[model samples]
Target: MLGAALVAKKASELGLQVKPWVKTSLAPGSGVVTKYLLKSGLQKYFDQQGDLDETVASAIAENDIVAAAVLSGNRNFEGRVHPLTRANYLASPPLVVAYALAGTVDIDFDKEPIGTGKDGKSVVQSSVLPDMFKSTYESITKGNPTWNELSVPDSKLYSWDPNSTYIHDPPYFKGMTMDPPGAKRVKDAYCLLNFGDSITTDHISPAGSIHKDSPAANTFLSVGWIRKDFNSYGSRRGNDEVMARGTFANIRIVNKLLNGEVGPKTVHIPTGEKLYVFDAATRYKADGHDTIVLAGAEYGSGSSRDWAAKGPMLLGVKAVIAKSFERIHRSNLVGMGIVPLCFKAGEDADTLGLTGHERYTIDLPSSISEIKPGQDVTVTTDNGKSFTCTVRFDTEVELEYFNHGGILHYVIRNLSKQ
Candidate 1:
């Protein structure tokens, strides 16, 4: 809904007519609470723009394809899916607008486009990503915006406070009662990981259904959280304590060439053997070893839930390496102070032999300072194998976010000082 609303507002500012379609289970007049808390004044923001047209509403009520294409097209609705599965596909005004304008979500200031403007003149397409990002930064820096400005108005829809401590908060160094003594160096010596294909955020940090009888559930249960409260893994994002214990808990993770009975790899500190992914993460944390994740194409491809990045950071994952990234999750990783590095073409995760068990060390300050687009960095694995892989961060803006420990901290510190 918020995505739709924002798109509608942006479209109106651009002098475009928008008729959004939303799908919900509100039963016409049910008062549902949502995690998104839009400022009451923002209602005027929508009202001043315009209202849904009768024709558009009628079309939405009558057509399913039109509604779905519009509402789910924008990445904003992608984040809200798991929590609102049954109600998501229903048509509503706000959602329709969001989907219709998904193409404009982030304009790239550097790219040329394939079309002419409405005026029939030559139209140079400015990149929306950089432009909107700069606008947001300027707004925040000028004290006209807050993290809350980016949040939606539905509270009960999911877990965690996007305005406060979403999963991305941890890597930015929030909620850690005591900073580890060597954290400064860990921050300095950051590694850039380059990954390969089909790497979902679920592989980086699973955030779907979890088995209640699993170790993660057991950990939560031991801490007095009940079965019902265990809920979906996505719901526990706010609590770092829970998330850290549950990284890489995907029930269907396949790590190696080995075929049958393969569970996600874990580190068992007691026996020093890699057991399952979640267990290894838990054990690694207990043993004070800092870890990070790296992957290939479509990194963080599933849901836009911030926990996919947050859970790993809380588990001592200092950074992530990938060949490419999905838009929102990349920002979320940066928001949490976890470095996300993309590989240059042809230098990827499989080529680097990242088994998720390799003791990888990074010489960040020097390496990152010299990083350029399509450049590779040398990595020394735990077994002493040395190879060069591509670095992920391609822009100065991204590097600035990494230096400031994530977007929120950067926003907060700049705004506070201002």
Candidate 2:
């Protein structure tokens, strides 16, 4: 609100207008913020330039022109704002307005004028927000009319709506036993997907707008959801059914199995049929075959998304062999009971001459209980290839998490004991 007010004041003083080509938007995080902006008399400035209360319509560039998104938010990681926005910058709220007025990121704010004055004079760019905390949060629990109209179950356990696509009872704890399922070997595993360096959580589990032809979108459509009603993958994350289907569903994912083509596709080994990543995993699960992922350096790099690890586990991926693993994501994998393995230094899939088509067997030297953290494990391929990888169980607690089949499983078993 302060930044918007400053930009409005500065623009008026300098007699400059926002560029015609710039698409502006103001998405305040909450309704109380809108009230504050309105009370401060700064909402009109935002409304005049951008839609005050609407979805952010990201600029879609044409003719291969690179697009950018400058925002006041903290994160500007790849694929966080929009898939089309390759270049992203995190700036102060005032700087965001300044850049929007400039209409391009390639500028030295120290030297460049944000815009020209009304008399063609060049100008260089350089408030207390209302506080309604007590009154605004008074009705926090008292929801609006639409929320009040819905019926809620009056039970200890949640009554999951089977027909609802937004949320579902996840299958993680279904048929769980009190005793922990000690770590099992990943035997005769097929490579689910092969990827290069810097594979982010966004690629593994996208949080963006779902493509109309994606598996998640198809699942929603099959249940009678219209195209416009299919919200983003982030919005429907509570439903494991949709999230499992949406795993590895990023449109820009580059699977080496696709022969240099960029898409969320993989090859089913036995039939050699090209299918969506989730479809292939489903078939492999039906056939009772374990699956693993092969990736290059810095696997699961961006955004420590829990779904990045959970979605792979739901897809029946038993293990991931990458050149390296992101710190938080590596722990997340162990928490989800997915084994993380790192190749020996200076060795990778390309160097080992192992194509993604080969069947893989990961040999733990002993039972999972006896396996020490960070111990070396051997991996063998059906095509006469063998190599060693360091099991990425960094701590004894993490090893125990894997031993119990997951952190949730361990927690549940311990709770049942008490």
TM-score for each predicted model, relative to the true structure: 0.51, 0.85
lDDT of 2 by residue, 1-418 (tens): 5555557656866876666656566778877777766765667767655321222333342333456878887777655665555678988877888887787899998898674324211211102233465567777899889999998788988888898878988999988888788878988899999989999888898577776788888887887889789877888999998889889987568899888876688999889999999999999999999999999999998789989999999999999999999999999999999999999999999999978999999997546768999999899999889999999999999989988999999998888889
How many pairs collide in each candidate, listed in order?
45, 0
Query: Could you tell me the lDDT of residue 103 within candidate 1?
Result: 26
Candidate 1 per-residue lDDT, tens place, 175-244, comes to 5222121112232221222234665665556454445556667776776877666665566665565566
- Cα RMSD of predicted structure 2: 4.8
lDDT scores in order: 0.50, 0.82
Residue 302 error, candidate 1, Å: 3.4
| Pairs that collide, model 2 | none
Residue 121 C-alpha lDDT in model 1: 15
Off by over 4 Å in 1: 1-196, 202-210, 223-226, 257-276, 352-357, 366-375
In terms of lDDT, the best-performing candidate is 2
